[model samples]
Target: MKTAITAVSGQLGRAIANRLITETGKDNLIGIARTPPKANDIGIEIRKADYNNRKDFDEALKGIECLLLISSMDHPQNRIPQHRNIIEAAKARGVKKIVYTSIVGDPEKNGFSPVVKSNRQTEEDIKKSGIDWVIGRNGLYIDPDLEYIDQYIADGAIINSAGDGLCTYTSRGELAEAYAHLLTQEVHNGKTYHLVGNPISQAQLAKYINDAFNTQLTYKAISVEDFRNNRIKDLGQLVGTIIGGIYEGIREGAFNLKSDFEKAAQRPHKSVPEMIEAYKQFRD
Candidate 1:
C-alpha cells in the first residue's frame, strides 16, 4: 500500500513521514511538501507540490492509496480554500482512504473557531466524497521552548490560562506514534481518534517543569482577553482570535476526550512531568 503524506516538511508531518518510512521502507512512503523536506538528505523521497495549485495537488495524489492531510498552516480564513482544493483533487484521483489531522473544538456550542471550523468543514467534505476517512482530533502540542518556558521559569509563574481546566497536551513524539498507528491500521478507518496525552492543569504543568529542571516555576491563572491582547503576538488578529477561542473552549472542556483514551493508546499516557524530563534530556 502506497502512502502519500502531505505537509511532509512540517514538524508533525515529518514525524509521521519518518515513522511511515521506517515501518514501510522508503519506497512505499512518499513525502509531499511545498518545498523539499529535510529528510531528503537522509534518502527519503520528497515531491514538490503546492496545495493551492490544483495541478500540483493532482500530481501529488497520483498512484497514492492513502493520503495524510496535515492541515495547512496558512491563515485560518484561507485554510478552507486549500482544503477544498485537496478534497477535489483527492476525489478526482479516487484515493482509497484519507486521514485528516483536525483541531479539537465543538462548533455547535462554541460558535466559530477558525481552526476548528476549517477542519470541521474539511471533515464534512471528506465524508461526502465517498472515501474512507480517519479523523485525528489532535490536542495542543507541548513545545517547551516555543511556549515561553523561560519567561515562566524566570518569573516563577506561567500566566494567562483559565483555572485548573485540564488540557491533555500531547508531545510531538506521542502524536507521531498515534498518527502512525492510524496510518498502518485498517481498523482505524471511519473513526475519529481523540489524540491527546495525559491531562494537566497549568499549575501542574508549571510544577512539572520546575521539578524536571530543578528550578521554580508557577502557574498564574488569568483572563483570556488579557492573555490574548498582551501575550500572543506575530499572529494577526484573525489567527489570534481563533487561538484565543480554542483555548477558551479548552478551559470550558471542549478538548476533553473520553476516559477510553488509555484503551485506544493501549499504554499509560505520558504525563507533563515526563514530557519536561524528555525535553531536558534533549536539551542536554
Candidate 2:
C-alpha cells in the first residue's frame, strides 16, 4: 500500500514518516512537506508540497492510496484554508483514504475555545470531503520549551495562570507512533480516536517537574490577564493570545480525562514524566 504523509518536516509528521519506514519497508512510503525533508539516509521518496496551493498538493498524492493530513500550524489564521486545499487536492487525485490529525471533542460542545473551533472546522472539512478517513484527535504536545521548567526548578518557582485545571498532554513521539499505526492499518480508517495521555493538573505538572529534578518548583496561578500583562509582554499579541486561548481550554476542562486509546490497536500512550525524562536527555 502506498501511503503519503503531509507536514513531513513537523514533529508529528516526521515521526510518522520514520515509523512508516520501519513498518512498511523501503519504497512504499512518501513524505511531503513545505520544504523537502533533509534526512536522505531514511531511504524513502521525499516530495515538496505547499499546503496553500492545490496544484502543488498534487505532487504529494499522485500515486498514493492513503494520506495522513497532519494539521497545518499556520495558526491564528490560514490553517483551515490550508487544510481545505490539501483535502480538495487529495480528492481530486483520487487518493483512496485520508487520516487527519485533529483535536479532541465536537466543535459545538468544545466551542468556547478558539483552538478547538479551528480544529473542529478542519475535522468537519475532512469528514465532508467524502474520503475514507480516520481522525486522530491529539492532545497538547509536551514541548521542549518546557525545559524552562529546569530553570524554574533551580529557582524553586514556576508561574502560570491555570489553576488546578485537569488536562492531558502527549509526547509528540507517542502521537507519531499512533499516527504511523493508523496509516498502515486499515481498521483505523473510519474512526475518531482521542490521542491523549495521562490526566494532569497544572499544579500536578509543577509537582512533576519538581520531583523529576529533585528541587522545589511551585506554581503561582495568576490571572490570564496578569500573565499577559507581566510575564509574556515581549511575545507579541498573537503568541500571547494563543497561549491564553489554550489555557482557557484547560480551565474549561477541554483537555481533561478521556477514554483509553481504542483497544483494537492496543498502542500505549506516553505520560508527562516519561516525556520530561526524554527531554532531559535532549537537554544534556
Candidate 3:
C-alpha cells in the first residue's frame, strides 16, 4: 500500500515519515510538503503541495492508497479550510484511507478552544469524505519542557499557570510512532483513539528534567492572567494567546483525559523519565 504523509518537512512529520520507512520501506512512502527540497533528503518521494492549493495536492496525492493528515498550525479560523483542501484533494485522488492527527482539549471556554474546534471540524470533514479513517487525538506534548531547559535553569523554575494539574503529556516521537502503526494497519480504520501517554504534573516534569540534566529547576504556578500576559509579551499575540489558552485548559482539567495509546501503537508508551533520559543521551 502507498502511504502519503502531509507536512512531511516538519518535526513531527519527519519523525513519523522516518519511522514509517523502517516498517514500510522507502518505496512505499510518499511525502507531501509545502516545499519539497527541504525534505528531499528524507529518502522518499517528496511532493510539493501547499495546504492552500488543491491543485498541488491533486497531483501529489495521485496513486496514494493511504494519507496521514497532520493538523495545520495556521490560525484556528484559517486551519479548517486549509485542511479541507487536503481532504478534498485526497478524496479526488482516490485515496482509500486516511489517518488524522488531532489534538485533545476543550472545544470551548479557552483561548485554545478555537484550534480544538477547527480540528474537530476537520475530523468531521474527513469522516464525510467517503474514505475509511482513523483519528488520533494527541495529548499535550512534553518536549517543550525539555526545549525550555536552559530558560528554566536560569529562572530556577518551570513557571506556568497549570497549578497541580496532571497533564497527559506525550512526546512527538511517541505520537509519530503511533501514527506509523495507525497509517499502515487496516485494523485502525473507523476508530478514534486518544493516543496519550502517562500523566505527569508540572512538578513531576521538573523532577524528571532534574534527573536527566541534574538541573535544580522547580515548578512555579502563576495566575492564568499573569502567565498569559507574560507569554504575550514574549511570543507576540497570536502564539502567546494560544500558549496561555493551553495552560487554561490544563488548569481546568481538560488535558487530563484517559489514553488509548497502547491499544493504538500495540506497545506501552515510554515513561516520562525514560524519555527524558533518552533525550539527554541523544543530545549529549
Candidate 4:
C-alpha cells in the first residue's frame, strides 16, 4: 500500500514520515511538503503540496492509498477551510484512508476551545467524507519544556497559572511511532486514538524537573494576570495570550485524558522524568 504524509518537513511530520519509511520502505511512502526540496534529504519520493492551494494538493495526492493530514498551524479561522481542501482532494484522488492529527479534549467545553474549534470541525468533515479514517488526538508535547529549561533552572521555579491542573505529556517521537503503527493496521480504521502519556500536575512536573536535573525548582501557581504579564514580558503578547489559553485549558482539565499510546504502540510510553534522563542536556 502506498502512503503520503503531509507537511513532511515539519518536526512532527518529519518524525512520522521517518517512521513510515522504516516500516513500509521508502518506495511505498511519499513526503508531501510546501517546499518539496526541503524533504529531499528524507530519502523518499517528495511531492509539492500546500494546504492553501487545492490544485497543489490534488495533483500530489493522486494514487495514494492512505494520506496523513497533519493539521495546519494557521489561525483557527483558516484551518477548517484548509483542511476541507485536503479532504476534498483526497476524495477526488480516490485516497482510501485519511489519518488526521488532532488535539485532545472537547473543543466545545475546553478553556482552549478557540484553539481546537477548527480541529473539531475538521474531524466532523472527515467523518462525513465517507472515507476510512483514524483521528489521533495527540497529547500536549513535553519538548517545549526544553526551550525554557535554562531559565527555569536559573530561576529555581516553574511558574504558571495551571493551578492544580493536570496534563498528559508525550514526546513527538513516540507519538510518531504510534501513528506509524496505526497506519499499517486495518483494524484501527474508523477509530479515534488518544495518543498521550501519563497525566501529571504542574507540581508533579516541577518535581520531575528537580529530580532529573538535581535542581531545587518549585512549581509556583500564580494568577492568570500575573502569568500573562510575565510571559508577555519574556515572550511577547501573542505567545503570552497563547500560553494563557493553554493554562486555562489545563485548569479546566482539558488535557487530563487517559491515553491509548501503549496499546497503539504496544510499548510503555515514556514519562517526563524518563524523558529528562534520555536528554542529558537538560541536566547541564
Best by TM-score: 3
Q: Which residue pairs clash within candidate 1?
A: none
Expressed as tens digits, the lDDT of each residue in 83-186 for candidate 2 is: 88999998999988899888763344322255567877888888898889888888877774374765676656766566777778887767767777777788
Deviation from native of the Cα of residue 224 in model 4, angstroms? 1.9
- The TM-score values for the models, in the order shown, are 0.91, 0.89, 0.98, 0.93
Sort every candidate by TM-score, greatest first: 3, 4, 1, 2
lDDT of each: 0.75, 0.74, 0.91, 0.86
196-247: candidate 3 lDDT, tens digit per residue: 8888888998888888788898899999999999999999998999999999
Off by over 4 Å in 2: 37-42, 105-112, 230-232, 262-265, 282-284
What is the RMSD, in Å, between candidate 4 and the native fold over all Cα?
2.1
* Model 3 weakest 10-residue run by lDDT: 274-283
> Which segments of model 4 are wrong by more than 4 Å?
109-111, 232-238, 281-284
lDDT (Cα, tens digit) per residue for candidate 4, span 36-155: 888899998999988999999889998999999999988778899999999999999999999999988657653356668889899999999999999999988888875688889888
User: Weakest 10 consecutive residues, lDDT, candidate 4?
Assistant: 106-115
Clashes by residue pair, model 3: none
- For candidate 2, the lDDT comes to 0.74
Residue 232 lDDT (model 4): 77
> How much does candidate 1 score in TM-score?
0.91
Models, CA RMSD each: 2.3, 2.6, 0.8, 2.1
Which candidate should be chosen as best, given lDDT against the real structure?
A: 3
